[model samples]
Target: MRLGRVFSVIAVCFFVSACSWFGGDEKRLPDIPEQQLYDEAITALEQQEYETAVEKLQMLEARYPFGRYSEQAQLELIFAYHKNFEPEAARAAADRFIRLHPSHENIDYAYYLKGLTAFEQDQSMFQRFLPIDIDQRDPGAARSSFESFSTLINRYPDSSYAPDAQKRMLFLKNRLASYEVHVANYYMKRGAYIAAANRGRYVVENLKETPATPDALAVMYQAYELLGEQQLAQSARDVLLANYPNYPLKSYKVKNTSLLETATFGLFGSESEADDPPRPTTEDKQGLEKPENEAQKEQETKRPWYHKATFGIFE
Candidate 1:
């Protein structure tokens, strides 16, 4: 009796599922009607109905997998997602198109769409422009955009989008270099001279082709000198000279501490001419100080008048 009851229950469940699948007034997914489905999807996309367009384009892809408009549908769907601010979906569609049709006539546009998706996926202005948060350092989205755009540039140098991609690439490149320089300057301001020098060195080594090269080299020279790395400072100076001969490295002033200290102390005492181990003087000493030493003594004797008056003492 229990087995019969179990069989009856199973039969009822299967019957309900079948009914729902075929008889519950659910619109049967239509067959791929070549141009009609494609046109409908395009219309949906044009009407800004991205979800509906995606549904239709997905049906077209499934039903007419190798149809003439299959790739076009896929590409348009990417644009639809992008237009709707659905960056992830757009990126996925673009990637799928590229994987499936690497050499498609519209492959450049596909890659460009990937870059656009990446660019759009970035955070808003508050996160990017505000100094209160670390969102400014979030390089993942920006780097992806740059890399995708760079790929397009390298692969399709003659593509119509090449110029735009190149411009974006330069902007991203400069942004990254500026980030490095900011860090270096931070270290410099904190008196972390070695750290600042190292950061600048990394830029010169890795980002020589960038606009930040000259600034990086200049900062590095200053940092090296501050850290007393004279050799490295000289090397940086040479690089600056070689790249920018008229930049005037000599104009950058650095103090001579030793000379400064000596000059500060020397004003208190006059140099003794006879202190040089009794150099033969024109006048005989006669057990007295030599003439040069006497001359210095006489000059020293005057005490510049100001010193004797202030200290109330004589030499």
Candidate 2:
């Protein structure tokens, strides 16, 4: 009888524990109404609760895909993603909105936000306050940002965001030009004269009116000279002098030291090492007179809009 009582007590304890576990999970809050959910999301955004806002916005979209607040919710969702530092998601959302509502009145804003998202993606916390050269880094994000801004400006010239977009495009252009110059410099250091010259030529042909143009021309001149192409070098030099008369040119010389010797810090040297080679001298080259043809003059006079807008001030 005692044995039967013990088994019954154990069975009752197991049943009670199972009931408590299942009972707790059975109680759940009712689903919020669609309007209430959107309101809560907006409130969360206003209160700087970005994660909460994202959750609420997502729930609203899923619950009421055809509701009146659906369109506005999608737009707000893009902003919430941006604030939460999800640039890729923000860009995707913006693209989706644009595709779905091509004729939407606020389409320009979507384009602007897409560009802004790309612009902020590559910028790190250290870059904000540091005197860092953004151009020296990867140009992928900058290029994407530039294209997005260009699209906005071209599609909606009178957009409220056009001016800001124009400014950012100029900055990206200069950054891309600077990046080309950096690559050319690296090629020059490695003695890849042809590759360096090609990079310099690319800059001259594509990135006109930027600060890095003069340096690019110099690189082309040096690289061509190293490759024994006197005519090409002179052409590059003439263009540099014509555009920037005051820019200085540094003489280029081929180092005679072997790679092993250079790596070993000149440990293996000839008896005549004490005598330094004569440094090459640079002569000033005069620039040709400007062309008087109207077409040529117009081409030369064409400048970026930001140049005129900012009166030569750059960010």
Clashes per model (N, Cα, C within 3 A) = 0, 0
Task: List, residue by residue over 225-293, the lDDT tens digit for candidate 1.
Answer: 877789999999899889988774533344333453465565534433344445565565564554676
Q: Which candidate has the highest TM-score of all?
A: 2
What TM-score, computed on C-alpha atoms, does each candidate reach? 0.62, 0.74
Give the runs in model 1 whose Cα sits over 4 Å from its true position: 1-34, 123-135, 186-198, 205-211, 222-228, 241-315
**Which residue pairs come into collision in candidate 1?**
none
> How close to the true structure is residue 240 of candidate 1, measured as C-alpha lDDT?
88
Query: How much lDDT does candidate 1 score?
Result: 0.78
Local error of candidate 2 at residue 44 (angstroms): 2.4
Please list the Cα RMSD from the true structure of every candidate, rounded to 1 decimal place.
Answer: 12.8, 19.0
Off by over 4 Å in 2: 1-29, 269-315
Instruction: Determine the backbone clash count of candidate 2.
Output: 0
lDDT of 2 by residue, 1-315 (tens): 999999999999998899768886577646889989999999999999998999999989988999999988988999899899999999999999999989988889889988999888867787999998786799898889999999999999999999999998888888889999999999988899999999888988988888899999999999999999999999999998998899988878767766645755765331132334334354423223333574464643455434444666852
